[model samples]
Target: MLSENKLWYQNSRMEETKALLLQARQEGFRSIRLNLFPAAVAEGGVDAIDAWYQSLRVLVTYGNSVGLHMIIDLHESNRCGVDASECRRLTTDFWSRTAGMFSDTRFDVSYELLNEPKGEMVSQWGALYPQLIKLVRSKDRHHSIIVGGKGYSTIWDLPPADPDQERIIYTFHYYNPMSFTHQGADWLKAHPSLAERRNIGWGSYADRTRLAIDFRSVDGWRSRNDAPLFLGEFGVFKRAPAEDRVVWLSSVARMSEERGITWCLFDYEGGFGVEGLLPAIQKGARRQP
Candidate 1:
């Protein structure tokens, strides 16, 4: 999924979203992640919910025509300072409406139920996921549902499937050894120095086998037996030296391809833009600098 900043409703004009979508397709991206919310919905309640659906109808139609798959991400429902019950209700209601909106569209679409659900423990995610999945299934049975575990959807939190539901795919974000990937990110508490040299634990080949094995180890039993993996989000900040970022990214790409895992770099613009990584990524040759 191409990581796009929240641009719901008029915050991002249709023209802007279209332009970005075109650019993303040109850059070999087939899917774009978007958050759905109506500005008045949160405060206005059910009536606002209706407005949100009307907006989504327009957005999804535009996205489909351009060949960009839409991954409707339920972001900010957990964070953005909302209470848990409110967040959960808004999220559930949104999906219920969303599934209905795209019920007949030909577009390749999927639902990422929530983005990086916060706090630790699988119980938190486990308690609500089955119900949310049922809601989505009720509206659209065939579309794939991407669900993440708690503690920011780290591999460690991935949960086992119900054995009944087979259409869902397990998803997780990867920005391991945060010191390296998040270098210079302002939101991070302490950024790693530009000159620092960090090593990915896999070492040497940095191939898919290592990645799969490493990821499989995160939660021990659950990830190994139950979930099929998707590296939902991963990218380095632009402030990091280009050379370092490229090396890390190459390892990610190689590993992803090897494992048959669908991997997407974290974003399309800002610190993680394709323009920033193009030179090094194009080389497709790994080297130790």
Candidate 2:
């Protein structure tokens, strides 16, 4: 299951999106992450929104035919802007509408309530977290939902689970020691280097260990929190040296397996190219005798 942030509704055409999805499927990927933006759906008004839904129907319908699982990620609110109150309202409304949109589709799909919700502290997630899950489940009872902690979905921010054991999965993004993974990334505030280091693979090993530790702690908080875990995003910049990138990604795959976690590299093109990394990942995924 490969997950790429393919924001279909944003600055792209429907035919282009279909091509990308089909290409990904051809490249041995079974899943694609999609972000549905309401503002982008209809720049005009409610009438435009209906038209956008028609477009969505066509996209998802075609995606299903191609053996692609669409994980619909509700990303960025127009009104709420990452605040708790705003996130709650935006999440509720988004799920309510999205749930209705795909209710009839037979495609293998999942709902990611929100993408990297900010402003809320890790500890605060314990309080408002369950309510968010409850709200999503209220409308979409059968579909699985992905939930993550605050601080941009870092492993450090996941909340505990309750006794009822709802059908939810834990998720997080990994770009630890941000300087190395995000080098040359213009969007970030910092871009440090990981050059001049020996045993570079251990660096990613340690980062994955940190994620495992965080997951263990979350599990300890509530014994019933045994839901499967997935790494929704993790990638190194394209400019990084190929050797360093391979070592880092291999370590991530090994550590994730040791801890029983499923991880999908961030993308096919752009920063995370499977063409360059797949052979390395395949070697790493193999078990040593």
Highest TM-score model number: 1
lDDT of each residue in 1-289, candidate 2, tens digit only: 2333334543367777788779878766777777566644545778777666677767777787899888887766333444667566656666777777776647578887777666552345555557767776666677778887765777666655454756687887777656567666665433333333223333445665674565565345345465777787777776666677766677666656766776767766665666545666658657422
| lDDT for model 1 | 0.66
TM per candidate: 0.80, 0.79
Question: Which lDDT tens digits does candidate 1 get at residues 1-289?
Answer: 4443334444356568677777777766777777544333557676555555666667777777888788888775335224566556666777787887777748578888887766432336677778889999899987889988776777776777666787788887787656667655665434435335344333345544555576655446444456566778877777666666776677766555555677667776756666445446545524322
Best-matching candidate per lDDT: 1
Backbone clashes in model 1, listed as residue pairs = none
Q: Kindly state the number of residue pairs that clash in model 2.
A: 0
lDDT of 1 at 78: 39
